[model samples]
Target: MHSEHPPLFLKIAAWGGVIFLHFPLVIIALYAFNTEDAAFSFPPKGFTLHWFSVAAGRSDILDAVMLSVKVAALATALALVLGTLAAAALWRREFFGKNAISLLLLLPIALPGIITGIALLTAFKTLNFEPGFLTIVVGHATFCVVVVFNNVIARFRRTAYSLVEASMDLGADGWQTFRHVILPNLSTALLAGGMLAYALSFDEIIVTTFTAGHERTLPLWLLNQLGRPRDVPVTNVVALLVMLVTMIPILGAWWLTRDGEMVAGGGK
Candidate 1:
């Protein structure tokens, strides 16, 4: 016989971990509404929406937000295309250097962000590529591709190859089969991967710092605000916005993929 429930201590430990990770976020949210701007205090002075209005009127915040959104969108798009193609090529195929290729694909994301950022910065300098918007997109796409590739390839492994064969046997052309059969089966995985990739890119600071030159994405702007203590309330508001933007997509991705093993046309 085995226990069906975790021990009480284990449950307590789990909840403790959750609180430790998220208590700071709760504090950030509380501070976003704090009326006192000088320094963060316990229990918060009082609640007001003044900071939200202040953030709204700031052109720099708006510009940073817009840049972050644009970079995230473009990076996700690039990741979806490249990652899907890579997964399709590798899913049921065995060839020379396949494992090596897979390892290379995952290396960017597996390494530390600072390492990846440094490597990208060095490569750009070698190639005489200016550090700016395009570099930022490329840098972001490198890791974003890994997120999409993992999601899609996992789905591919679960999916039956016979679906493609059956479509062909039913007089469907390659494009038609892919459009009608494959796309539907891949829809959730692709969407989840895209959302995850977008969220990752949107909040990324290290790689963007190395590649952005003078460009300020939302994360960079928030980082710069650290030096301006007077902007604490506005910074809190922006931080809350960033958290919401990243967290929502992450939650959406989790919801989309929670039942992923039961994907359409899966199994033998």
Candidate 2:
């Protein structure tokens, strides 16, 4: 039996839309090797490792990359802990204002990025807190938690209660049950959550702007590159590098969460 699909026009339109969306990225990746001066000429005049070498020795770019990695790692770890706890609490029992709590958890992701950035800035000003690596981590974690929370909550909802109860019946204490059983069950969700957190932190610029007073991350570095046209192709190289750095975690998370099968033997 043949299953009905979208019309030919719709299929073409879908592919067209994808191409329109990603054409610039393709260009950026291709021009990374162009040895020509500042201009990004198609069919690049000559291929060279100048920019790649430049990116390697550039201390500022290296520092930004290091900062970005630190922020993403910290944010992901913090979000994993907080989000997992929140999910566990919600899964354990029903409570008053559950919907409100859940909505609040989701607000950071739902609201405009500018709004979140501004809000973080305002809060930091009110607290008289200095914007730096710490601020960046906090800012990223605020949203990262939601990514983790969403994944864990969905996983918990589908989880069988019998498993936890069985662990308890086998004389497992709360911490032991969680460490051995619950944590294992949530391993995949936690992994997915952390990856999402890392990816989100990697590309985040608006919030970083509010939180970063002096130190620059890779995204901020890229933003600064925009003012100088001479470094345009160099920017493309850094952009490609940035994309690769962020892409791995998101892809890993997608693969892990897509099936949710890995979580089956989690706690044991």
Candidate 3:
């Protein structure tokens, strides 16, 4: 038996698309080590770690980094619980509002992020909610939940319900059935989803714009650093650092979800 793949031209086009998408990030990584302080001059004159040290010394950048970490952690934690619950409910039941509920859960990820951000901003304004760290976490969680929900729901669909039934029949209550059978089956999905949620929350800018009041994330801080000539090298260093840190969780999620195979291995 032979595995089939897309046509050569289509494959080339797909790879081309990826290259086009990632080229800027590659360029940024390259320029980050450039010894020259001038504006992104290509084929940099030299390379050094001076800029990395400079980035470390910047007080505001450190604060922004800390703020981003806190927001992403909170958002990821909230997304894990809500997304998993939503996924479980959607997977286990058929009801009158099923489609609508599913659509609403997915809307944040499916819609243009700018639109979601704007709508969330408007809703918050209407509710007279102050923009702050909490607001940022809520904004991020709204979308982050979608990421986790999709992953967990897909895994839940693939899992065998008989195992859960067996557990329940063996004098295990619902919570016990979940703890042993269902939760173990969902471990990989939950891990992958949390990683995805963290990644999304870390770099999100549009929603953060609406929700972040007097709070700067790393991305926002980078935006601010754009205007300063002397800070250029340090900004590059920080950008590269952010890219590396952000890429880890994103790649981990991709690895876990690659084949969509629900890991049957139960936790110890």
Candidate 4:
């Protein structure tokens, strides 16, 4: 018997779809190496590393990059803590409105960015909370929690409750069981979740726009650069850098989360 493969037309369609999604990213990356600083001419007018040097030297861009890094780091940290707690609370528990609670937790990521942004903005105004670095971190954390929550809850569902029961029977307290037993099982999932949350927060624009009062994060900086044709090449370099930074974590998360046999004689 011969193994069945996808039809040739389907294979072609899949490749075409991948190309369609990635071709623009390739163009942006290519433009980063263009020698012509101002205009995007055909053939790129030759290639050089000048824009990279320029991007490195720009203080404003450096500041924006730092701000984005700070915000992403803070958001990811918050998400990991909160999301893990939420997963632990909801796991293996049945209650009224549980589904509703889960839906509400996912609302930030499920809704359109603009809608989330507007809603957050309105809430902040209502509460008299000024928008700034803290607000930006809070905004990013809102959606970031969903990523961590999804990864954690999925892992939790797969985890065997018998192990936790065994730990309890062995005189281990809740903290000890969680620290030794559950933590090991959840390490990879938490890592992948944190990485994904960091990536999302790093590149977020819409929610950041509403929450960031004077803080100019890297994405907002890129948006501001659109009006300057002379800085196009430099901006492209920055954009490429951002893509690479975000892509690594995302790819790492994907690799970590790939389907594989779970460790035997463990929670999951």
Q: In terms of TM-score, which candidate is strongest?
A: 1
Where does candidate 3 clash, by residue pair?
Answer: none
Model 3 scores worst on lDDT over the 10 consecutive residues at 259-268
When 3 and 4 are scored with TM-score, the better candidate is: 4
Task: Tell me how candidate 1 scores on lDDT.
Answer: 0.92
Clashing pairs in 2: none
lDDT of 2: 0.87
lDDT values of the candidates? 0.92, 0.87, 0.86, 0.91
Ranking the candidates on TM-score from highest down gives: 1, 4, 2, 3
Q: For candidate 2, write residues 202-228 as lDDT tens digits.
A: 889988988899989999999999899
Best by lDDT: 1
Candidate 2 wrongly placed segments (more than 4 Å):
37-39, 260-268
C-alpha RMSD for every candidate: 2.9, 3.8, 4.0, 3.5
lDDT of 1 by residue, 1-268 (tens): 9999999999999999999999999988989998755347776878889989999999999999999999999999999999999999998799999999999999999899999999999999999999999999999999999999988998888789999999999999999999998889889999999999999999999999999998999999999999998898899999999999999999899889887664322332
lDDT of 4 at 103: 92
TM-score of each: 0.95, 0.93, 0.91, 0.94
Model 2 lDDT, residue 77, Cα: 91
* Candidate 1 global TM-score: 0.95
lDDT of 4 by residue, 142-162 (tens): 999999998888888889999
